[model samples]
Target: MTSPLSHLATHEVTNQPPAPGDRDLWAGDIVLRQAIARHGGQPGALEPYARALGTAAMQEAARDANRHPPELHLFDRAGRRLDEVRFHPAWHGFMQLSAEAGYAALPWEEAPGGHVTHAAMVYLASQVEPGHCCPLTMSYAATPALRTTPALAPWLEKLQVRAWDPAIAPMTGKRAITLGMAMTEKQGGSDLRANATTATRDGDAYRLRGHKWFCSAPMSDGFLTLAQAPEGLTCFLVPRWLDHGRNPILIQRLKDKLGNRSNASAEIEYDNTLAYRVGDEGAGVRTILSMVHHTRLDTALAPAGLMRAALSEAHHWASHRSAFQKQLIDQPLMRAVLADLALDWEAALKLGLKVARNFDGTADEHRTFARIAVALAKYHNNKRAPLVIYEAMEALGGMGYVEDTPLPMLYREAPLNGIWEGSGNVICLDILRTLAKEPLAGEMLNAELQSVTGTDRRFDAALKAHRTRWPGLPPEAEARWFAESLALLLQGALLIRHSSDAVADAFVATRLARGSGRIAGAISGCDTGAILARIAPVE
Candidate 1:
């Protein structure tokens, strides 16, 4: 007779294998190779880690496109997901792989490359799959939902499998489940108070009644839904599938968008459907903030991968293309432009890493430093990537603009970085709000600035000018100042963190040794000594 575990083994073994298109294995491998090259060809350092992450990414990519393929009604005219898709099994698998690779604990790493790798992975994931990996949002939404509905607690733990370990136990190869958090009704986007959804407690469950303009992933298993509870505005875990396992949620229509064509957006109506409460009454806004921070970081880093890909494409084009009877790269002006693009790309990558570092450093801080850093990163890349791509496009003449070149697809994807996970204005405001609550946030920011610029008069003057422009004194004025200062601090940190002190110094010394006036001028302009002095005091 077979042992009792034999049946279990049989069942587990019989589970369907991941389908042919279920994994974007090639994309993950390509990204890993690119990341290693960008970081000085240290493939051995991250190869093991990359292999693990690539496996997960491939699995998720396949799930994202195939699992419950976004129906015709789930998207807007722009192709954005109007309803949140339920988190797919692949989503959870990737998150689990990341956690296993020690990405979640990366703040503790002293070396910058580890942080860069994590940041790069984030960028890659967001580009490959957006909106689904809103862990920050889910963490915020799930905690409260779990407390009220004890039955949903197990699912909450299950959700973490996607982010922490998708290849083990019950979650092995399982995908993520998504929770929708956006509001598009008449009340407005920023003000949750204007929401009209109502929840009436009915014994063990509640009845949800409302019309949500944009519900991302409506096909998802459940949502951390915002509805007006008796006490105040509250959130609930409303399942798309009802008690008997039938979907009560209705998808009114899908949106067709310019970018992120693969993602589905839908307008949805939530009838008097059964729902479970999350957290206490009137805490929907507070809970949602957690999710926002997570997504903001994601939104911030998403463009970097695209930028890297575009830069690589441009570099290849420059080396091969010839103009004016000379290789494009041989032209001084073109070379200068390419060099600038490289600098910008490097700067963007570093900025993203710095943000990840901060995220790793202060896991418990109430302030959303990661969110601010992510916003700045996104804003800068959004601004710089297009310029780089266009320059590359010009280098290729007509080919770059056409689909024949990767630049066209990249160009189309670039703008969406600025729009999603909260717009630029929204991100700036978020930083301001976070800094205002933590007054020391400004001083800490100053400390980082001091580290980079030292105590030089020029650097001091810049700091003073910034303070004067936006002082952290009056409540309103202080908030603005804190935001601006934080932005500066983040920028300075990125510059220092990503810059190889040895390389910069060697480059400068060689130029000075050769009597290169331009190099000398750049050195003089930088006020390195002053910056060092200021930074020394902080250390």
Candidate 2:
């Protein structure tokens, strides 16, 4: 009864799930929906972009863009210096889609709950293509740093445009602009103060001369960099395109990175690169920290999306594929693993969104909470993401190890966010510093942890035990443990308050009560059916 089209086929394609067709990222994610409303964001703003991102065409686009990474073109046929990095059309298609959807411009556009909306979009788009997210994330983060320089007002205005303008023209002629950053040098990976790039005052602007170890989004219209000014370390805005011609900024080479292959990162030289100074000279770190802070939020939010994508893929495979003459999902052990992974996924989303919500808070406590909670979420979420993804990948057995599935991409991407902005130790130390320096941060964290108190005896006991163990702050050696513990409490508390009893109980029971073994699915007393239902019920 097979169609004539299949007559030449080796065999019928059965048991394989239909290729994940068009998925409404927003519509399908009930947890994301609840988080949006709970955190003061309107859902409609995310739907259009979500729908577009979920299309089969978009899926192909994401796939093609990564499969064919960006190519670096340093010169034209005439031997003229080009210093341009060209991408596959599919990459540009994603940039255009994100640009038009206001991914970078959303928070600054005066939309209600802009940060929350932006955070959700980060979560959604990351599930589709995370590589393209770097430049947009930098663009979104650049607003505050740009605002400090009145002379750069025009540059700031250009960023607010709700379009993706990828042209070689000056900002004056461009409808929109995306910015990049080049801060770290060979001597200074995370220490901006160690920068040796020199900047000399030239009329109203400055001329920079040096090389950077890393220049994120090398093809971006302009770059925010740090250079050694006469005063001290200073932040400079280096434009790639000028009114007359290209600036002296030269691309040395694009980084052969481990992942995020779709995005172009580079090493470059500023041979007297024309630049405008941002913030006061010597306050470069302070000014650029604003951008870093915002970028950190995306780092936290992106891992959640990665985990979800991996989980979805594994869930689909399990549902369709059979083992031992029974469906994989029907096996109690498989269900436990998927359900356990779901707990981490859900916890990350809730914690990240909670931190995103605080971003919209204008009050003092809100700011304090945002600063510290972002680090906690970023630290722990990133740490757990790789493991969660690896477990999900394992569920697919051998197929998971191959690039034919999304598991490899998801796994590679899982570690990048952790390295960017700040690594694990950097974030942990930052947490300790914040607790020591900012009294309100500690107070707000305590208030958050206590809010869900008495709801569960185990949670209450864990909280009490945590406070007793730390007393104030643990030693530097215990920084990771301290940070992880606090982040877990916050995640557990949020899950209890916002999630279903099944989710709340699984989290507290396995995580808080230590009812589970070290690895995922190593637990007892879990309602696997109820928890797995959150992922997708097995028919």
Candidate 3:
């Protein structure tokens, strides 16, 4: 006991965390890159640009942006009633990078891939920072509705400009602009028709006096708000500033959200706010729905992107972090979990891109397909994201629970996309409504599924079962179940059509053939190695 081994000292073993950069984000995501090519995007410029975003320096900026969050300044020091929201410089940096990357510009420019390419860009940028995506998405979606109103047409070009100047000055002084929207009021959450806001005709403009329960990105140059007019509920474009003075757009307070803190969401009051009508006086919902449709697509893409980022982190950690003298990824149970998460994300990407490509086509068939598929994709992917992210976080054990890691942020942001455009029940009901009105919707969906006939016997059986049970199924109370089945069938079809044998087989066996369990890491007999390899962030 007295003769201690003094020289035999313990040394701390370091299982260092993954270095996030040193690779191309776009090229590394093989599924997304393949989808980009499939959709006809050149990818020449996107590769290097995406790599820049993946740099450690850029990732640091993303962290800083969110860590600092945005600060709301309701009035100036002199109490001059200046409604402004101040952001960390990092947030502005992200905005400039994303705007120049063509996330918003692609759709209006009618670039090579149109919405398909635009969706890819959105997916990449979201992997880094998601809050700024709100303003960018609103700007991109605003084009169609803006085109409908001649008064707002001039701002369309401004919306498309690639430069992002976050100046609080007038639109005349800014090189480019982003947009926001305010739809719901305290009385009406999803029921917009219950809105108490009122708008009065004033010459060529209108004066709005109402309180919006939720006005996202309140600092935006303009907002498309819904208010009641003499005709009915109407859409109005309320600008931040006018030639006379700033519109009486009073910022009540900012929402203390769980995540996406980099962007400011405000509860605002408009007192005789100057606004211009966007569509027919009585057709506010119909007019703004075109924009809503586009944003809903973006909403779906966001969760997919977040899932990709989380999976990359988990994979990186597992490959490097060891236990019991072996890498976690090499362990059987861990491998199964990672593979299962990968399968879910890969299927989501395939479906999201497919719906986006449909938006690019002008055929009536394409439009009809998108009417139903968007809701299904949005409903399923957004809802599943939280579970995937949670499992990915658990894959890292306690390391994932700390703020020093990105997984926590991803987990917090996971539920937002599901809640943003619409919640699960709202989206499911939308699907039912579409099927009821456009009876051709079912035929269109079936025709799309038929393209992959005989690809997988399991998928064939599942589709047959769904068609057989259609008459007996009560879609009203069981809307979510129908939506889930529709989602799985669509994802299975896409996997069969585009993915490798391992991926397709896993999706069919687990998702379609009644072999999957309630949780991740439950599938068996599938090539987990092949499934894991396909989702590898880099070679």
lDDT by residue (tens digit), candidate 1, 103-215: 43342234545444555556545434433334433432344335455667666655543244222122212454334553556566656678898889999778888877766
Which of the numbered candidates is closest to the native, going by highest lDDT?
A: 2
Q: How much lDDT does candidate 3 score?
A: 0.86
lDDT of 3 by residue, 43-137 (tens): 87578668878887888888899999888787788889888889999999888888887888877786666888778777787788888899999
TM-score of each: 0.69, 0.98, 0.96
Worst 10 residues of 1 by lDDT: 530-539
Model 3 spans with C-alpha error above 4 angstroms: 1-11
Q: Write down the RMSD of candidate 2 (Cα, Å).
A: 1.8
TM-score of model number 2? 0.98
| Top candidate, metric TM-score | 2
How does each model score on lDDT? Answer: 0.53, 0.91, 0.86
Cα deviation of 388, candidate 2, in Å? 1.0
What does each candidate score in C-alpha RMSD? 12.7, 1.8, 4.0
Off by over 4 Å in 1: 1-70, 73-118, 126-151, 162-176, 180-182, 362-368, 371-375, 378-389, 455-460, 473-489, 501-539
